[model samples]
Target: MRWSAGWHGSAGSDRRPAGGRTVPGLREVWTCGWPEARVRAVGDGPVALAVIGECGADDAQLRDALPVVRAEGWRALTRWPGSYLVIARSGETLAVIGDLAGQHPVYYRTDAAGTWWSTAASALAALDGAPVDVTALAAHLAFGQPDVLAERSLFRDVQRVPGGHLLLVGPGGVAVEPYEPAAYAPVGLREQAPVVRAALAEAVAARIDDRPVSADLAGLDSTTLACLAAQRGPVAAVTFADERLRDDDLAFAARTAATVPGLAHHPVPGAPGTVYYAGLDDLPGLPLTDAPNAYVVTASIKRAVLDTVAGNTPGPGVHFTGAAGDAVLSAPSSYLADLLRERRHRRAWQHALGHARLRHTSSFAVLSRARPASRVDLAGAWWQTAAELRRPVRDWIPQAQRPLAWTPLLASADWMTPDVRGLLADAVDEAAGALSDAPARLSDWSDRQDLARVGANTSGWRALALAGHGIELAAPFLDNEVIRACLAVPADERGAPGQYKPLLDAAFTGTGVLPGFVLARSTKGGFNALAYAGLRDNAPVLRELLGPSSHLAALGLVTEQPVADALARAAAGQPTAQGALHLVVAAEVWLRQLAAAPATWWEEVSGRVAAA
Candidate 1:
C-alpha cells in the first residue's frame, strides 16, 4: 500500500444525546485521541460497540452493553475484557468480536463492499488495497511472532482476529465463531486464593478511574498493580534505572514505594531517560505503518519511556503495566500438565523433577521442554529465541521425534541468506499451520496456550505508544476479571520459581498484599541496560536502517550479508545474535515503516466529537 499516515478517526457514530436515546441507524464515532476508540452503530439494531485497547468500562459500559449486543448476537460479545473490538451489523451481515486475549486486535478485509475491520493492522492494510507479502515479510522475518499463534498478516489480503474467535461476514461468506474463554476448570489452592483475591481487587479497582496512575514496580504483576493501585487514587510507582545494568528494578521499586500508601516512587533514570537510543536514523515513524508493534520498543526507548511517563504524570493519567503477566503468569513445564491431569504419574515425574532442579535443566530437559507443541515450534522459528541458542535439531537437524511441532533453532537457514532461508522456511511452514501439532497437555494448557500467544504486545505496543504521548496504559494483569482469577491457580501452582507470579504470590499472600520483602524478591527485574546500550548507541542508525536501500534488502526479504553478520553477532553478546538482533531489527523496522505508510491517510479530530 502507501505510507505517511497518522490521526485518522470516524468509524462514524455520535450525535443525539441532548435528552439521549436516538437510535435510528446508529453511527457513533468517538476518538478524542490520547489513544481512544469508540465506534458504535446499530440503530436498525443488530450490534456494534467498540473499546479497542485498554478497557474496564468505557462510557457506561457502552451504554450498558448496547442492549446485550442487540439482544444476544455472538453471545453478548464476551461480556467485557481489557482488550476489545466488537462489530455486529445486521444488514449485509457483518460480525466481529475479539477480546479474550486477542488483545484489542481485529484486522479484517472481505470486500466487494461489506467487511472491513480495524484495530489498525497497518491501517486496515492501507484500507484494504492490500499488498506487500514479501512472503509474509519472510514469515515475520524468520518464523514470525508479534501477535501470536499466527492468523497471518504481513499482508497478502490481511487477516487476524483469531483469539477466541467470532468473525462472521455474510452473503454466505467469511465466518469464525467461539466467544470468550470457552472453558477452564480445576480450581484449588484453597479455592484459588479467594478467586485470585477478588479478581485482583476488581482489576485494581477498575484502573483507578479516580485518576492519577503510573504503576509498574518491576514485576509481581507490577507489584500487584502497585499495591492494588495504592488502594485507590494517587499512585506513581514506575521503575527503570539502568546504571549500566547488572541489577536494577529500582531496588524493588524503592521497596515498592516504601510500602504503598499513596505510592510515589518514579525512578526512570538510565542516562538521558531510559537511554534514548539516539536518532535511529529517522527511527521508524509515520505512526509505525502496519504496526504489529513496529519493532517492539526502541524509537529511543519508546521516546524515553514516553518522556518519563508523560513527564512525571499529573494530568491525563494511567500507565499501569505488568505486560501480559509473563504470558498470563508463567510457563515452562506447564506444571507437568497439571501432574498428568491428576492421574499423577508419580506426580508427573515428581513435577518434572522439580522443574529439573529449578531449571538447572534435564529432567529430560524438563520433559521435552514441557512440549506445548514444542514451544509452538520455536515460537514459529524465533522471536523470543535466547535460551542459549534455542534448538531445533540443536546444532541443526538432529532431533529424533517428540519435538517436531516447530523445530527451527536454525541448524541450516544459517541465519538466513540462501534466499532468506527459503523465505524463512515458508514462514515457518505457515506458522506451523496455526499450531496444535498435538496440544492437549492440560492444566491450563500452559495458561491456555499462553493466552493465545499474547498478540499485540511489548505491553500492548507500550499501550499504543502511550497514545502518541498523552498516556493511558493500564494492565491490571489483562483483566477479564483478572484473567478469570488467574485461571484459578493450578497450572503447577502458577510456575513457582521463587514465586514471582505464583498466583501473584498466592494472591497477595492470601491478601495481606505485600511484605515478605515485596513478595520474596528472588529475581524478577530487568531493563537490559537500555537494550544493551542500543547496540552501541544506534550503531550508525542501525547501519542505515539495515542498509543497501533495504526494503528488507529489496525483497529477497533480507540478505545484505546476513545484515552485517547479524550485526556482528548481536554486537558480541550473542544470545543467538541477541535474539537475532531483535528479529532482524524488528524486521527491518517493520519493512521500513510499512514502506513509508500511506495508502489513503486521514486524521483530524478534536475534543468531544467536535462538540456537536
Candidate 2:
C-alpha cells in the first residue's frame, strides 16, 4: 500500500570499501498491516528502514531475527512475508531486497556518484529521464513475454528484480545473488514414495489445524489435501459452481468431500454478467489489450469465497488455495525435462513443434511460411526461438545500462535447465561469482535451492502476490520431497507404459485421499469456452468500454470473418470448444479495468503482457 520515491545527493565517490563508511542514496517505505515496522538511523552514511504493516506470526519471527541479522553486519535482512521494500547503505554499498517471493516490486540503479533505488519501477524511469520504449511495447503486444529481455520496458531505465533474489550495488559494479533451494538427496522410487506421501499428508494436516481455514477443492490438487485433512478435523472445501468451471468432475469434489465424515463442502456459483465488470472496480488500470484476464477472474473468485466465509466467521481468517499445485506438483513437460531425459527424443519433437506454433503465431509467421525450405530458414527459426526464450531479461536488469546492453545476461540465466546439475560450467561459474560474498552456496541442488531458483523464477512471484489475501497455495505434486524422489526414479519406471504421474499415483494408493473416478480421470476441464460465452452474453459492456472500435477487431486479436464463420459452425451443432473465447474474455476484462484507471498503465499492462 505504501509508495514513495526520491534521491539523496552523492556523498562519496570511492570504489573500494573505506572501513564502515556510510553509503548514500537509499529509501524505503511500507504502508499496510505491519504496525510494528520501525526504522532507526543515527551515526551512518545512508541507511533507512521502513515497515509497512502489522506483523503476523511469520513477520514477527523475522522481526525478532533482524537484530541478530544486523549483528552479523548484514546491511539488509528482510524476513517478513507480506509486501515490503528494504533499502540500506553501509559504506559505498547500497543493498536493496524485496520480499523473497517478489510480492513487492523494488527498482534500483548504480552510477558515478552511487546507487539510487525505489519501490516502483516506473519511478526509476521518471527519475532517470528516458522515453518509454515502443518496440518493447510492440513485442509485449504481440507475445505475452517480450521477444528478448534485452529490450527495456516501455518506461526507460526501469527494471524488475527477478523474484527471490537480492540486489547489491556499489562503486565497483552491480551484482544479483539468486536465492537457492535446499537439496534433498536421491533414494529409490519405492523407498522415497512413502516418505514423500507422508510428508505431504503431514504438511496438509498442519495447515488445516492452523485455523478455521477453507481449502479450494478443485478436481485435482487441493481435493487430495482436503481428503487427507478431513480425516483429522473439520475443514471447508470450496469450489466455483459456474457451468464453465463446473467441468464434468465438479461432482467429484462433492463426492470426495462426502467421503470425509462431517466435512462441509462449499460450492460458490460463478456469478452472471461479464464476470469482468464485477471485478473491474477492484483492479483499475488493467491493460485493455494484449494481456489475459486470468488474474482478475481468480482474484474475483478468491474475494468472493473469502467474503462468504468471513460473513459466517467472527474475526480475521485464513484461506487456502491450490494455485501453485499444478506447477509445483504436476510435472509439466517443460519443467520435467531433466527427470524424463529418456523421452528426450519425443521431447525434442514436442519442443520443435512448440517452437513452430510460436513462430506461426507471430507477425513473422506469414513471412516464414512463404519462404521455401533452406538451411538459412532453419537457422533463422533457431535464432528466433532462442531470442524468444531470452525475452525476460529486461525484468532482471537494473535501472542503469538497460538500453545500452545488447547481450541479455539475465534472460539467458532464466532459461538455464531447471536442474542445477545440468547448468553449463560457465554459467555455474558466473553464478558462484555473484554469490561469493553471499552467506551460502548458490548452486546447490536442493529443494530450498529449487524453490528459490526455479520456483521463484517461474511461478513464485505470481504465487506470492496472490497469497496476500489470507490464502495459501497447496501443491501436493510439487512437494519438494515428491519432486526429488520422482526425479531420482529411472525414466522407464517413472513413465512406465501409458501413465503420467505414475510414481505419484502409486505413493498415494493407500492414502485414502482421492476418489477412484477422480484418480483415474486424466482429462481436465477448460473453462475458457465458458468464459467466452459469458463475455459474449455481455457484449453490450464490451462495446461500451471498448468504444465498438476495440483492438480485438482492429488488430485481429480476434478475426472478424473467422468469428462469423465459427459462430455459424457452432450453431449447426458442430463441436466447437473455442478455447480462444476464454482468452478473449480475459483480455476484455483487462481492457475494462484499464478503461477505469488510465494512469496506472505500466503496472497493469506490463505484467499481463510479460507473463509466460
Candidate 3:
C-alpha cells in the first residue's frame, strides 16, 4: 500500500498542504511507507533531486550528480547501483523516472489544472473515482504482456508510464519519453559474465543492511541468490518440501546448505491448506494490488513460506526471491527466429534440430515456425496476431504446441467472449499501429515483455509480503544494472539448446559463490501436483466466485460456462486451461477488491480542483 504522489500547476487551494514537501511551480509531494533513511534529497527551491527506494548512493553523490541530471535528461540518473525512483525538478520542469522493470511503475492523469502522478495507479484512479477499463483489462488477460496498451492503465483515464520510460511534466505539458532503448548492441556472453556477476552482487549488497536476510533455495536462480546473500552474513534459507512434489529441489537445497557457510536451512513441510487457491474465500484478507496479480492465486503457498521465515526472524526483514531470473537469464526458443533473421542459416538449423529433439518434434516443424516469425517484424506480427484473434475461437492447444509469433496467443483468448476478443484485437491493432520504433528482433521484444510481466506480478507479491508479514521482497534479477548486463549478450547464446540458463552459468561458474553442483544441475521443478490439488479441493468456492455475478462476466470479458468447464476438466484430471483460469480468477478477485476499496489514497486539501 506504499505510494508517493505529487502534482505540478497553479496553487488555487486555500487550505495548507498536508505533511509533505513543496517545490517550485506550486508543486507538492507526499509519500507513505517510506522511511526517512529511504528518502534522500539534494538541492533546494527550483532545482532539487529526490530518490526514494534502496538507492546505493550517499547524499554527496546525489548532490554531485544533480547538476548533470538537470542539464542533461533523466537518463543520467539511472546509473546508480540499486533500484530506486528519481524525481527531479529544475525551473518549471519536473521529471519522474521509474525503473526499467515495472516494479516501481509510474502512473499519472493530466487535466487543465495540472498533471498528477503517483507510484500507485489505484491511488490516482481513486482521485476521480474512475471505473476499470474493460478493453485494457481484456488486453491484459488475453496477452499477459504489459505494453499491449502501453499508455493505458487498468483504470480509465489513468495513464501508465511505460517501462524504461520517464514522465516529464513541464510548462508546456506532460510527456512520456524513453530513457533506454528496447535492445542493446550484442555482446558475447563471455565478455558480459563478469559484468553480470558484479551487477548481481551489487544488487544483493544493496538490500543487505542491519535487517535479517533470507532467500528461497528452491532452484538455481534462488539458490544463487541465497548463496550470494550468505557471502555477506547469515541467511535463513527456506525450502518448501511436499511429498506430492516429485522434484529434487529439497534434496539439492539441503546439499547446498550443508556445503555453504552462513546458510541455516529451514525446510517447510507443505500441508493441505498450503495449496493454490486455498484462501480465495476470504477476499477481504488479500492485499489490494495495483492490478490483477498472479500471486493472488498462489498466496497460500507463499504465506506458508513467509510464516516460516517470520518464525525464524522475529521482526521486519528482507526476503529475496528468484522471481524474474528465468525471464532475464534465459531467452525463449523463439531466439531461433532472430538467428534466421540475421542470415545465420547454419546456426538456425542447428538450433532448430536441438530444440526439436528436446520437444520431441521434427526439426522442420521447429524451423517452419521460426521461418514465418523471422519474416515478420513486430508490427506485422501484431497485425497477424490480431487477425487470428478476431477469427473463430480455436480448440484448446498446449502453449508449447502453438505456433511462435511476436506474441503468442495463450489459451485464455479462447475463454473470452467474441465481443471482448474483438475489442482486444482492436486494441492490439492500435498498439501495433503505434509501434513505429519497436525492436527489430522478436527475441528482443519478447524478452523485455516477459521481464515486465514478471516484474509487475512480483510487485504484487511484494505488497502481499509487506502487508501480511512486514517483509520487503527483493528480486535481484530485475535490478536495472543486472538487466543491462545480462540482456546485452545475444539471446541465442543465452538460450542455446541442451543447456539450462547458459547466461547464469557463464556468469557464476568458477566464481566460488555458487556451488559447482548447483551450476551443473539442469533439472527444474514444478507445482502441477499442488495446482491440481488446490483446484480439486477448492472447486466449490471457485465455482461460486466465477458464477453468475462474476464482474468479468458482467463486463463481457470472460464467459462463465467456459471457465466452469475448465474447472470441471481440472477436477477430472484433464489437460485443462489452468493458466487461463488463473488469469480469470485473479482478475475477478481484483475487481471485487477494487469495488470494496475505500478512497483514502490522498490527503485532504480544501479547494483542490478535481481531475478532468
| Highest-TM-score candidate | 3
lDDT of each: 0.55, 0.42, 0.86
For each candidate in turn, the TM-score is 0.31, 0.57, 0.96
Tens digit per residue, CA lDDT, model 1, 1-612: 111111112233222112222222433322223232323333434554544444556576666666665554565555554544555555455556666654555666665434555555665555435676665555444433333335666677877766666776656767665565435665765567677677667666655665667766776667777777777766767676657766746777787688767788877665653442355465434245344343354555555555677777767677776767876566545556445444567766766777678667667766665454433423443333333223331332232222422322422134445555555554555554555432344444345445544444443465445546756666656655567667655566676544456666666674656766777766766655556566666656777767787666776655566567555654565533454456566667666655564433323233443221
TM-score of 2: 0.57
**lDDT pick, better of 1 and 2:** 1
Alpha-carbon RMSD, each predicted model: 24.1, 12.3, 2.1
Best model per lDDT: 3
Sort order, lDDT high to low = 3, 1, 2
Which digits, one per residue and each the tens of the lDDT, describe model 3 over residues 1-612? 767778777754322223444532335766667767777778755678888888887789988887876685678888787778888888888889999888878999987888888888877787778889999998888888888789999989999998889999888899999999988999999999999999989999989999999999999999999999999999999999988898999999999999999999999899999888989999998998888999999999999999999998868799989988988888888998888898999999998998999889999999987788899898898899899888999888678777788888877788788898898899889998988568999988988899899888998999899989999898989888888998998888898887999888999988899889999998988999999999999999999888898899899887887888889999988888788888889999999998876535655566555432
Which regions of candidate 1 fall more than 4 Å away from where they truly are?
Answer: 1-63, 67-81, 87-92, 97-102, 107-132, 135-152, 155-203, 207-216, 219-248, 261-455, 459-555, 567-580, 585-612
Error of 2 at 468 (Å): 13
Candidate 1 least-lDDT 10 residues: 1-10
The predicted structure with the larger TM-score, 2 or 3, is 3
lDDT of 2 at 238: 74
